[model samples]
Target: MAQEHLDRLTAVDASFLVQEKESSHMHIGGLIIAEGPPPAYDDLLDSIRSRLHLVPRYRQKLAVPPLESGRPVWVDDPNFFLEYHVRQTALPSPGDEGQLTELAARIFSQRLDRDKPLWEMWLIEGLSGGRFALISKNHHALIDGISGVDLGQVLFDLTPVPTQFPTAELEPWRASRTPSPVRLISSGVLGAARTSSRLAAAVLRAASNPARAAGVAKEAMTGVADIAWATMNPAPETPLNVEIGPHRRYVTIRSDLRDFKEIKDTLGGTVNDVVLTVMTAALRNWLHSRGVRTEGLELRALVPVSIRAKDEQGNLGNRLTVMRGALPVYIDDPYERHRAVCAAMGDLKESKQAVGAEVLAGAQNFAPPTILAQASRLNFSTRLFNLLITNVPGPQFPLYVLGRELLDVFPIAFLPENHAFATAIMSYNGKINFGLLADYDALPDLGRIGEEIEAALAELLALARAERAGASGNGAAAPPRIGAS
Candidate 1:
């Protein structure tokens, strides 16, 4: 008999699986474009096969105990086939970004099969330039934004020449025999007991150092209060929040990272502040275009903050918490809007929102599968935020897959029930790419929002230049145009 192996899912990771619904898929990934001719499908397969050992979890699938006695565990998939997870497809006619976006939307619409590993990579050929795109989707239960970035290092090479691993160094793999129902139940009970024991030990340790524990407890309580308040006070209803169908529309916005930094430097705030400002401006204009009055309107964005420590860089599963970031669309001036964002974000950073979220999420560890499912749903209730906005930092240098250089990356964020719009941003190789996913029917004007984003950037850039010129008392000394190096 093969060695029996089992790894239980963390509560945060398990939440994603329970949160997934027919209309709301919980997969997160990106649309990646690379320069140079596409690599042969067989060669790409061979490259992935060699590096499979780096991410052993990818070869495994989930196993739920009989009657859902405990959270699912990761077990090896005996019939694992590389071809099934990695697929190849081509666009028809002269391939362009529009066609690719449509294709990506369709691919993202379908959820991964429950019986297989929760991920897929689609190698798409036939683009306008001598480049190709890869659409990667992984269940949220499998990975989060920070860990996903780590996965990139494993899949892509730093230089143009690809790294090769000799098969002699790597051993063959085999799946352990699947655990029977009785064993699963017993293991679940034991796991629960171990968790309780660990928690009790932590509590005892805290009790020993009462002063330190008191300070931590106070901070946690404050954070919990903020989170509870946010939950009770529902965000204002907007065109962006409504019943979402299974179909989606995907749009991308290309921007230079320098523009954001310039705005931040000229206008006294962080790069993220500039980003939030642009988003707010775009939302204001989009709402107006849709005949909605935007007086005194402040939309809320569910911003995910990564808590993954440096030591846990490559570990999988979610290590994130959410905060309700305010989007002050009511501010008419771009600079004023940016200032408001900076101030609000600064306050949020100092507050206990994220800490409270972590504490609440940790409590789910003791919850049974049924309770965990309901609690997970409640944690992401529609009243908490209007839309989701996530920004992930990436490597500054170029990355290559089989010598093909990765040119651009547009990260995709999944939609929650009744939420029609979400934006995911990734800054790579000096360029910041925005991927906007929307409900196809609810957002036929998604392209219009993309246009508004560009317009907002231009407006902010001009203001920043003017401010710099005034500060320096020389117009020529102001920063060059946005795209300037």
Candidate 2:
């Protein structure tokens, strides 16, 4: 059966598209270094080819309506060629960690071609050790699942044994004639009319149930108003925000997830609090090294919160909202910083900041694609938030591809316009991995920031261990107090 209805991009997702520019590439990706006896490049390509049906979006290309009439839609690319997207490459002779990081950074700096499917998979071989790495990239619009996070979990299995995926029946490719100009305009008009009708219906229903509708409307309006008012002030100017170049530099940081949990469990704060505490400390140090004074400074961070339900794992696309978090940049003490972050996050949660922001974001669904894109650009150009930091949890158990044991997984997140640095955190097995991305020229000392993160975490971990030891020596284990919702 030929599909008739177009798969359109939601306004929130379209916002990402409009926001993307030469300096800022909006994609979420990961670098995976696997263990010995690497599989042949052909075998890996075969594996991905066989499973493309399971992820139909992989072969679909974007179709923008005429004159930006409406949001873009997903259309099967009749000229889809798997080899163009899945590539093979070899690292320099005596491939070492240094060379691999450089290679990954260069690959990440290049933007994905919007004309084809917005994704790529590089099968890299010839490492210093008998190992290989897979660098995967996908546009923010494609894998924008809950919280706007994904390392392509759908492409792997839980164990090293490659489970044979039953071949799913796929639709054969058949090119359709291009839509007429009249057809595109009609589509846009229809979309707008539908939105208007829904608004009218909502009003009528509210009029019928005056009491219930008024209550709901009042609450929603209040939430949106509070969020808008709170964000009117621009974020503090800092070295972290600057004019960025088209090139990007990548850095990775590693730590045990248990260390973070240990600190949170014993210190009476959430895991996120501990993470922020350490991140703030590192950011403070990094800025100080750049000769910037950090006294009485509070850097705002745009943190993504996913509203997708647990069972909606396989359904991709953006279902995310933003939370404005105030990082305590002035606080020098690690424990004090942790407490401050916990308190601020707790308040933000209580205020339902994300809820209000989401309500406002939902309004975009009724907006035109052009208008939505420009609005996002405005937010990016003006330093609305100091930066973005996201922590996504990966599988604790091992995942494999073509019988290869997946080792480390580091996620490289998007850096918006004028925003020079961003961090994407992911924890797998026993380790928490951090991928730091920065403008290649603006932040050449990016590794210094990564080093600080590691150093700060190490300091906090040592303190937590000593504290836990003291409590154990004195009495029974202290119960953890819950704070954030």
Candidate 3:
């Protein structure tokens, strides 16, 4: 029992469990289209329900004992909270994009009940084009991005064939059995010892190499200073920073990965670099068209960098850190902006940004839940960055569910305080799907940003193709011209 409790606690800490006030929920919003008539959505729901019963982790809840005596625990309840995790809703008349987006916003704003498992799946139906949507919101405590993706594999079948889930019953005494006090004390001691050892080692390592340690300390101080500066001098008040109601607006733009690859290949940068470059160009044009003069405007965007291993797939939680970079909106020349973005990203990659994020995540593991949660809230509420941009890599091959071929997949990133808009880009089945979530009031014309993104990519694609044509003499290798679909 003590071992089980410890394991659960480690899982929670590993997931960076949010404190009560801080909103640490990450959303995995997918826009799935069924080729044929929608299959029994209830049947899929039942499959999930049955599977949840088998996974003890899903049935576990946050247990805060009497204030004076015990720490939080993860005790399993005999009667699982299934309803708290799965929900079904139907769209109103006309069932258009507008209606669906409004519903999604409402869903995003609401917090998940903490007493039960932290996750919810909404099976939405009623689309004009005979399409339905499945939006799943899971607490960051459940899994990181890789784990979340892995959970999708568990819940969904690659081949359209449905499989049976385990439905074995456990003994009645399972829920009532609590960890023994002795065992709990021993486990706590061991956890404390491990933490102490890590701290001691870090100190020793720092002492052994004074110069290297000094350099690391300098970098840490610089990072802290940068964060402090950002908080003191808030980012420019753009349309993205404002009060947002409990309303969500979603818009998706699909582009071929091949087109992006062509641009990357021509430009000598990663796919992400090209994507950010395109985003900068789009924002430049969008703001300029709105009569907002582009001066020394540096839009700080939070780019989520995945920290999962190459082989570790399908675990969900937020195993990511925000890489703050200045979007070169002031650069009048699109080509110059792209080059500057690439250089900026290159510098960030060379720095210890990723390493620092992992270290910060490690620190959270030993931190008291309350302190960690407060820190998270402060970090986000401080406007550390202007907006969020996340890029999640999806399965390269086609994925099927209950014999239905997935037409496309879009990821919806949750909005934090001060930053009302988030852009999530996911690549699935040869195409890139960009989903934008904005506070309805602040970004009333958020949909226009979607159009801008498309236009920017098209511009880059054209430039890449023209450059290829000029170099290759034969136009066969040139990328296809992009046009409005």
Q: What does each candidate score in C-alpha RMSD?
A: 2.9, 2.4, 5.1
Runs in model 1 deviating more than 4 A are 474-485
Consecutive 10-residue window with the lowest summed lDDT within model 3: 476-485
What does candidate 1 score in Cα RMSD to the true structure?
A: 2.9
Ranked by TM-score, top first: 1, 2, 3
Each model's lDDT: 0.90, 0.81, 0.68
Output the number of the TM-score-best candidate.
1
Per-model TM-score on C-alpha atoms:
0.97, 0.93, 0.82
Kindly list the per-residue Cα lDDT of model 2 for residues 114-218, writing each as its tens digit. 999899999889886799998888899887623323435667767778877654655554545445566666777787788789889988998999999978877
Worst 10 residues of 2 by lDDT: 145-154
* lDDT ranking, best first: 1, 2, 3
lDDT of 3 by residue, 1-485 (tens): 22245432542343344533343244445555555455576776677766654355676666653431223556665566566567777888798867876777678767777777666787787866787777777666565555666676676677776666545563322454455566555555666577779889999999999899999877765655555555686667676676556556778788999998988877657788888988988888878877887799888887767777766565433566656777888997765677788888877665656556555656665765555666666556636677888887788887766777777777777776656688889888899888888876777788788888998898888877777877688645544322111
Error of 3 at 269 (Å): 1.0
The candidate maximizing lDDT is 1
- State the TM-score for model 3: 0.82
